[model samples]
Target: MNCEVYKGSRKEGAYLFVADSKSLENLPAALTEQLGDLEFVISFDLATRTSLASADPAEVMASIKTGGFYLQMPPGKDLETC
Candidate 1:
């Protein structure tokens, strides 16, 4: 499956992945509001073995399939407390 990637303006390194481009109707309003502005990153093929920076491609695809979207938040700042 192909997926569209969007970067969150409010948070650095935050990303949103959806099954379709410009399709946010299925996502909750609260999530959209929290994400602020979105910038298109790129379209990716989930069927292929493509590596992501901080998330598993397989998990992302699964989320998109089940929830219509996948949220990838930035890594925690402090590992000691995590």
Candidate 2:
């Protein structure tokens, strides 16, 4: 399956993947509002990838198939609490 990817302005390295280039229409208004302005990144084929930077390719594909979108977030940084 192929998908169009978009980067979130609110968070670094955060991405939203959709099955179709026009699939952004299906996203909730709240989500888009939270994600801020989305920057077009690159198109990708899920079948050709085994894994993404911080997301499982298969899982992302599955989500796209079922939910029409998948959000990829950056790895969490370790925090020290006193």
Candidate 3:
């Protein structure tokens, strides 16, 4: 799947990945408010990776498929933001 990653302004090392970088409005209001603003970081294909630096590629892809986006929080902050 084609994926785009975005950095969140409210927290360092946090990112949001989605299929369409242009439609950030589709994100949940709570999530959008928690993250503050988003900045485009990079884009990649899921078929190209076995794993990501911090998240599992398959898990990330699955989250994007089901949730419309996947949140990657920095290290221990994963459970806190959601």
Candidate 4:
């Protein structure tokens, strides 16, 4: 698995690249363990044109305040190099 994280306007959001679907399924757990101090939520794709997975920035931050984290992995590069 390959993962990179960037600080959002309010909290930490991670972008993950998994080699396959199986890896993707396990991503949440992997991230949770990696981000020891912070709480992690679901992953989002910024590049997504649809609103299916869209999340409010304020809500994301709010979740973090409660010890939860949010993740976003837009479609682009492969996890191998990311």
Give lDDT for model 3. 0.84
- Candidate 2 per-residue lDDT, tens place, 22-47, comes to 89988988778777888999997889
Off by over 4 Å in 4: 1-29, 32-54, 75-82
**What's the best-to-worst order under lDDT?**
3, 2, 1, 4
TM-score of 3: 0.88
Candidate 1 off by > 4 Å: 77-82
Candidate 4: lDDT over CA atoms? 0.37
- How does each model score on TM-score? 0.84, 0.84, 0.88, 0.27
- What lDDT tens digits, residue by residue, belong to model 3 across residues 1-82? 9999998788778889999876587888888877888889998898689989998999998898888998888776663553
Worst 10 residues of 4 by lDDT: 1-10
Candidate 3, after superposition: displacement of residue 32 in Å? Answer: 0.8
Global lDDT scores for all candidate models: 0.79, 0.81, 0.84, 0.37
How displaced is residue 9 in candidate 1, in Å?
A: 1.5
Could you tell me the TM-score of candidate 4?
0.27
Candidate with more favorable, higher lDDT: 2 or 3: 3
By TM-score, highest first, what's the ranking?
A: 3, 2, 1, 4
- The reply for model 2, stretches above 4 Å from the true place, is 77-82
Better of 1 and 2 by lDDT: 2
Per-residue lDDT value at 27 in model 4: 42
TM-score of model number 1:
0.84
Q: Candidate 2, which ten residues in sequence have the lowest lDDT sum?
A: 73-82
User: What C-alpha lDDT, on a 0 to 100 scale, does residue 11 get in candidate 1?
Assistant: 68
TM-score preference between candidates 3 and 4, better one: 3
